[model samples]
Target chain A: MVNVLIDGLKERISNAIKINQSIGIILPASNYPDLVQALFERINSTPEEAWVYVTVTKPCDNILSQFEFLKDSKNIKFVDCISRAAGINKANDNCIFVESPTMLEKIGLEIINIFKEVDENVKKYLVIDSLTNLIIYNDPDIVTEFFYHIINRTRTKNIHTISLAIEEEELDKYLTRLIYLNDKILKVRDSFI
Target chain B: MPITELSKNELCDTGIEELDVMLGGGIPTGSTVLVVGSSGSGKTTLCMQYLINGAKKGERGVFFTITEPLFKLTKNMEGFEFYDKKLIESGMVNLIDLRIISERLGLDTEKYTVEDASALLDILRDIADELNVKRLVIDSITALCYRLQTPEMIRDFIFKLGSSLAAMKCTTLLTSEVPPRKFQYSQYGIEEFISDGIMFLGDIERKGDLIRTFQLVKMRGAAHSRTKSAMSISTKNGVELAPLLKSRE
Candidate 1:
């Protein structure tokens, strides 16, 4: 079963690279640690540089500590959306909260545009830790629209995206439909062991 | 029997067979059930089964996880039969991680502002609309409670969450972790009262091995098993249930 999922994912990733530079969405519904590791393995296997987005719903361990786990890998870059925005907005570093509608739209668009600039062969991967929380404080319609712009730009740049979401929220449909509209879709369920 | 125009109270199905049998049929379609239990209980697993079963029946499900990262949760649940990666990508079964929401919102003590529960609820509804979600679950309500500074504030939030979910006609489940031996009513008592139904999961020590159990403590307008039933976990089913106790008549 694991092989099947991996094969399907490899096929999707390879096909997207071969065909039009397309948008891809991966929905992995596993425990938090396993999901992050699975994504890390996938990113590590890719030959090109990829942008990984991590969105947090609640405060976990420090982001810096989590980032350290990936420090050995040089192909990736970390942009602390929470901290960067805080810096840009001239807010304190301790400020942790959801993005305002205006801020979400702005950052969502910015991330898409960043993916657009990378070389086609770079295999740029955009990871959004979740769409559920992004849309939680805002209107889902607006969030959908926000993703639409990102999706449109990503297709133009030939970048792929993998979005991680918790399966218990019942918000998978929204994220999955976005993936369905793209060239490839990868869904990761829980582990047997 | 192709039927339409089901009332809010008419559309619920607890999604648990035993509980449904206890009730006349199942939870009324479109009713929200609050599954409260301590950590490690089957709250998340139970909710996952509810959504998975709904997906199998062609009723779309959305999973919103606030407690853990999406990838880790998926990896942990990989053993479950319902953990279909395809279903997730195809939008038939969806998972939404709230951690990202918190990050984007930017947690600032200096700029601390009360969260808008209605706004948060709208985001969920938006996702529900896009995915055509008929069933939904928020793994735990602990995150929601922590965000608020006052009990009254949580009460207000619970009230709004209930009304918003009810308006969608989406049968929903919200889980909350409670410590053992605590009151059935939690610090946020409003969630227990406002929610249409409440279920409890607990652990008991017996002969050195920890025994897990689940019971339907309260189901508004429905009847559920009163006896404590043992629960188990396996790689294939993230969570499995076996009757440890039967009605002793």
Candidate 2:
């Protein structure tokens, strides 16, 4: 098994997780799919840790398809808020399907419920796939408030969270606000090599 | 609480046949439907027509005016051919003036607690029960949200209101003011999520002129046409919908 923390583009992220520090990642949208794969690969390396992946932009099946190697992993669960909004009703085990991404209250409640159901002995990590899609569907202030609540809740439970957003030059005020609340903000460049 | 569930065949007429056709028959019974649009997009007129049509069919209707006064709403509806004061006089159609109550409460408009919202819902429930109201319309829930603080509070109020209405088996039409800009369908963006169905009204620029258009974004349990239909409003007919501009051309 490769040590994701040893070196390369994801080394910073792997190092932060090792230190139990929550970080926010800002990267280009073009590299989002690849980054997700690499991030999950790092999670797969730790069999003792449980993960709750909250997908806002892409459907759960689409994200799961990209990481076929981790499909049968029992440590990972998904909170899908995209498929139902797109009118797709396919179901999967260990998955919670929300009506829409704009339902922030429902999404928060589902995350809490999932955390409760997981074994207390297992270390938990919460990953919000992307904040860019959330901003498109909700008011900026509302999305920021949701992040505040989620970040606080995860901290109390000793769960580390890594939120992702696309790098935009025009600069989004809300993204800036989220970065302020995070422990650290890591920018991933286009060329890992 | 779970929202009221309705089968495919269980439908309620929206009063306008063309609009109903666009909705794939009509809105499902006991559903909370959000009518979203910017100013002057006829969101209020469509809601009025729905209530008036229901009253005409012997279905008791109630209109809760949150933004506009009841007298002003009645006066404006007088221009429509379907306007009937006798229905209101006979108690078949009731208009509850919430603006007065909202003002009298003197609560902080910017920061209201969940209890304040619950008190408001209690008043509505009492009125709904006393009149056996089957059809309900809240003119501009956007105004109501403005009186609350956080998105969580706003969503909680809606969830509670929707649950109570569902238990009463009342079909509701909630009018929302769409904010200016792209992808903004409602004031807080939570309205569309909590609603069982969404109907968006907007102006489409065509041939160097603006044309009113109606689109069904989503309906939870029913199959609806996803096309944007050309629409118009007049005193004679409250709302009239035509085929899509592309198909008509």
Candidate 3:
């Protein structure tokens, strides 16, 4: 599975990128962090291209360290809803730590705000680290509504968005809706189907 | 609702520049304006700013806290530079916890009887009269209504309180809470009818962002913009209003 993911990710993403910019990736719950690193690595982000990472699962520091390419970029920013909510209370320069993951409005505002620093003409990307954790903090309806709103908004702004989600049987409804919301889909594991 | 007949009545400017524009000068003096919103929708901040702004204009403003304590309310206000301590010290702005007033009047009950509600209303009137207050804000009408028990009692209490304060020419703002994304303005469904004006402070989803919104739904005395506008609150500026994004296009 690991070999299949790492090798096929770039080619699969490149093929999909040509057809559609808004893509959803469904990963097995086994090891998405490594899968996430691989996905980010495969994209081969550039300094000129603006990136906004919305992380609900891991700290911004952990996410930064995992992807060494992300470390050197001055253009990349983060919407870290977990750090302060977890009682770390520590602040990062480019990161906007939302009061709680439940404050979806504030998180969306921060994402929109940070992206303001980049020129409108710049190639912008919004990568939601994982929605599986976001669902835990918010109700199902709210979670779905948020993505429905964000994806629609980002499309108008000409921003490429990649939302990562862990495929689980219990959350099949949420996963299915998420897949339908995006223009492209890359399913790493499809046990539910 | 086309209300083309504008108020020739005196205006009590809310001190928010854009809001004043939205309100067509400001709230008509001696009118009871309901500021309704869900939690974190900037209702308290808007109320505090109105009071502070009134104080700046040499109009005595009194804020009665119904749910949160006066200390916590003040502590929250501590960040706002507009909330001056001098206003409190010089007796221009007064922050009174309603519990103390209720206790003093012996009407502090788990659920107020009709007579208790009347007495409480009278007590608030006396406070407004004594202070020579030009602006008044009850931190919430919801919590106060919860103690009123019945809808009839809540209506009676609000109706009396609004008229009495209006008679004193006290431009009042009564904060109200509704669950987020819900259209139910007043929990009792009666405060809207009794109040002279209704200013809804709610959230509107614009691109995954729950933008705080202010809509002057129905102001009986003024011709104002009835559309929902985006709102933001900060320590520097208590409440700032901007035009809302209507759609993605």
Candidate 4:
């Protein structure tokens, strides 16, 4: 497993991964760019781990452009849900395109298939780019239910999963329930290195 | 200038006196207003009141329910003083249940095609023409958007629906589910842009108590208060808008 790039947070994050495979992170929307950069840096450091990045907010091309270094990595897989939803049909050999974020079943099935295809020698990780965007397209209860299923399935498969969400003053009841379902909750601060 | 007088013919009363006052009279005639709020925020009650007000004034009204069944809706409204069963029985107030139609048409999909939108538009037009509906309400448009696959489809549906309603000169109110976000105007965020007016209902926590607040975000051509006012509901009066709260800033 690759350690996060943040100074003090690296050890804590690694410890959380050891204690519990599934983790949920809450942070201000403004901090998402920094977090994503740090996350990709960590993923790039680890050669044996294969990652499936499920993006609900941005298109695969946009995400790839930000972390261009990871584009050539064989261990990185992209599940582009935004492109098909936006009516773009561009095909990429390295990415799987889902129709839309509302098609939770399709996304879940794709994740399962990816897990099956990867060899046992490679460690697997699933990163849901965002839960906030998912809730915007679907009902809160429905999104929460989908997360429950995905988290439980990933845990059973021994595949590490990370879900990200924006912090709100009053946490949504459904999202609060989702946080409880996860093994650990990490609050990402804007000042974190 | 003296308080500008509003022509009674140009405004449609919202059934709530205080709300009408806050709206600079009622909403302009033939305008589409988006009523946005979270669950249990009295969105349905406001829609029901709008239709009941029209029925009481001898104007024909139609309510298209996409989320709940007609029977359950009527049963739940039994406690409201304005919910008269006779209005529906007399055909003055028509309830077109779209839930059954949605199920049959398999409306739940990744994307709602143009054909699907046309089919829905046809049904709405037919009912509007047959009933000569002067007032119209879609219990909730949020549920409809969930079935439609893309943001474009949802936007197209709202545009067509608004245009059609305006052609009939029918005052329409569409309810939208407000997401958990504190600042969201509507579910997909496009509803407020397409609507002629937007009304927001939400609760504020003060000393651990939830105080319901109502605000008129904007009204295209009318003069209205922008301040957030306290709100309450009762069986006798469906919705009441109180004085605006002091600005937190």
Candidate 5:
């Protein structure tokens, strides 16, 4: 599987670029901006085309604006994966939903459903805003099983998914297992400024 | 601080030479220490070291595991030089196996009640007392915290557990996986306040090198090393902490 290392702030962003996969940033809640920057810069480093999906739980913040910048960047297509669907309408494009710690299980299943809606013929990559919110909002058993399901679908359907989470004391082993299922894993660590 | 009949000499060693030295020879006898860290940061290994050290000294040790089965637990530590399987078999070090407890509770077994914390606490207390456990380890307070789901409840349970251990006059180590970045304020915030002591293990990368470090954030009535020290886990040594350093590199 995948070998992951929790790296320093500078190294963290670069490591994300090196792996060139969806990354999981495990830090304190306040460090979300640093992690988002790390991901954004990593995405910008590549000359190749990329379709970046920014799905957040809470309302728009600075990271949302950063996504707007990527919209003008060469070879990058951004999609909002959060759904505002009533039941299970997977085909709606503008009907997006936001991710929040309170809605981890709900949004998780929605993201999975969205993946199900995508045409199998197209190559797609999914970046989960974070795995920590999932851990904070849901039990590890549920989150692990949820990630397992996502990994299974990604592999069987050739979809690449990068999930992020802030590292907490006991959840690393579980995170390691989830990363093991992925093609590659990148971990970020930050030095408080 | 007022002196008590219990002295620091009665505490069990952690098997880490530098750490024991830093802890004023060992953890304070009959006190609780919360061990917090990020995922894969060696929280369990620290607990294992504490228990194995106790077992080696002819004192009883108890491990209450929440997530892994006994085989996997044993297998994972099989490579660690200090894992004393003999001690395990001889009952010097006992694993309560919360996985089994949860499984039984799922099957509606009368032995375990998933509905209440009091029942779980009672069962745990019974086990600790029956063994005359000198050192008690709860693999994680997080699993219980996740199920319980309230800071207030967690606060009460943690305080109660700490008090129970103090009453039993047994030293305890409770593991909690707190994101180093987010929960640094208290590791889970209020937990450090409830527990007798707080020990933190962090895996940090510096200048392209991944380093494992540890520190004693707070201890109620004991003299402890204040330095953030280096630590490591390998086949030869399960969890080894170095002498406390002056600063984080």
Candidate 6:
């Protein structure tokens, strides 16, 4: 049977892909992997949109290895904020690594720089792998405020954003603000594998 | 100044594509660049590649070895594809062991005065002029600077030699090192000041992996990135680069 949650996200993405569009995804703990896969598959098929994936939970290598197809995709870039701090000092050519997740400002600059670098004709998408991971490393209030600016900033550049949050992670304070900043909220309730 | 004005000064490419990108095309012609690194951080490999690349461009080059002999250096170079025997045999690239030069000059290795340093500089300048080379590398300027024994003499000698080489249009790379845990680019903290450019090859110890890194710390008269990149040297690739990952706790 087709996954209802996956179908829901795919259906919602069409309208959410417009300029200034921001979709906040709230995922169930066990269904995180399936929903992200579904989301990227939708993105991968869309030829005009180039993705800039910002990961705070995992390094770029881990993500690229898990999503092996991404290795061949030149349409995507990564902003990994984890690897060297974990004692792994390597990075792929397509990915840019921020020194630490704590370096929030640097992360912001790198994200903007990547967006600036992507082809101008291609539509841009900024996907925060998960925002809760950032709250764990930073103060909730500040991360929310900073992301508020990120959403607005990217919107002006004709870029859409999809910020994910895991319900398994109890970051109630920040999640509430995340919802307010987003134009639409999505709940991925796909049954956990 | 007119908006259309541009510099016509010549530039010397390092032949390392990524490095040349970081250097804003290339180092200015007749510049002195310091290649500082800790031991085993691929300083020699980088310098060797630079000279070999120059030779491929038909611009003759010379390498003055201060830390090792000519024979051993060539033996190590054999492992890298950049090491071309034809260039060395044809005198397109010359490797001169500094120890032999010292022996010829009759200067005491342990103690070298400012006058002795001047004499050494004159001899090197003569050799560089004689060869009519476009590129020159002094592997481990620290070892040679140690002989000078004082900051003033080292500074004086570097300045004099750099000025003289500039006149002859010989782009130079001088190797030096920094101790572990210390931030200074050079051993004596003075070589960095005199050199026209500073490229530091550093290593980070993480989880038993010695991660080599490259940073173009200073490149005068050039637009360069301040970001650090992960670096590696291999027999097939010579020197390769990748993005440096973020650190973890």
After superposition, candidate 1 runs with Cα above 4 Å error: A1-193, B1-16, B105-112, B183-185, B246-249
Q: Score the docking of each candidate (DockQ).
A: 0.01, 0.01, 0.04, 0.01, 0.01, 0.04
CAPRI quality band, candidate 1: incorrect
Q: Which tens-of-lDDT digit does each residue in A30-129 have in candidate 5?
A: 5666666655655566535343343544333334455665544553333332332123234323223432333333343444445555556654566676
What lDDT, from 0 to 1, does candidate 5 have? 0.63
**lDDT value for candidate 3?**
0.78
The TM-score of predicted model 4 comes to 0.53
lDDT of 4 by residue, B1-249 (tens): 465666998889887887888777788888888989998999999888889888999989999987888888999898998899999999988888886665577764334677876787787878788889889998788887777878788888877776776677788889999764377888887877778989989876532335567889988768887888767665645676655333231
Relative to the unseen true structure, what is the C-alpha lDDT of residue B73 in candidate 4, on a scale of 0 to 100? Answer: 92
Docking class of 2: incorrect
Q: Candidate 6 on B8-87: residue-level lDDT in tens?
A: 34778888877887776788888889998888888989998999998998999999988888888999999898789999
- Residue pairs in steric clash, candidate 4? B110-B149, B111-B149, B112-B149
Global lDDT of model 4: 0.78
What would the per-residue lDDT of candidate 2 be over residues B130-235, giving only the tens digit for each residue?
A: 8898899998889888888788998898788778877777889999997643457787777776689888898654322355778888887676678877676756
Q: Interface root mean square deviation for model 5, in Å?
A: 17.3
The runs of at least 3 residues in candidate 2 whose Cα sits more than 4 Å from the true structure, single-residue gaps closed, are A1-193, B1-9, B103-111, B247-249
**Model 3 Cα shift for residue A81 (angstroms):** 12
Ranking by TM-score: 3, 6, 4, 2, 5, 1
Query: Candidate 3 residues B7-125, lDDT tens each?
Result: 54478889998888877788878888888889888889899899999899799989999888878988888889788988988999999988887787777556788888778778788
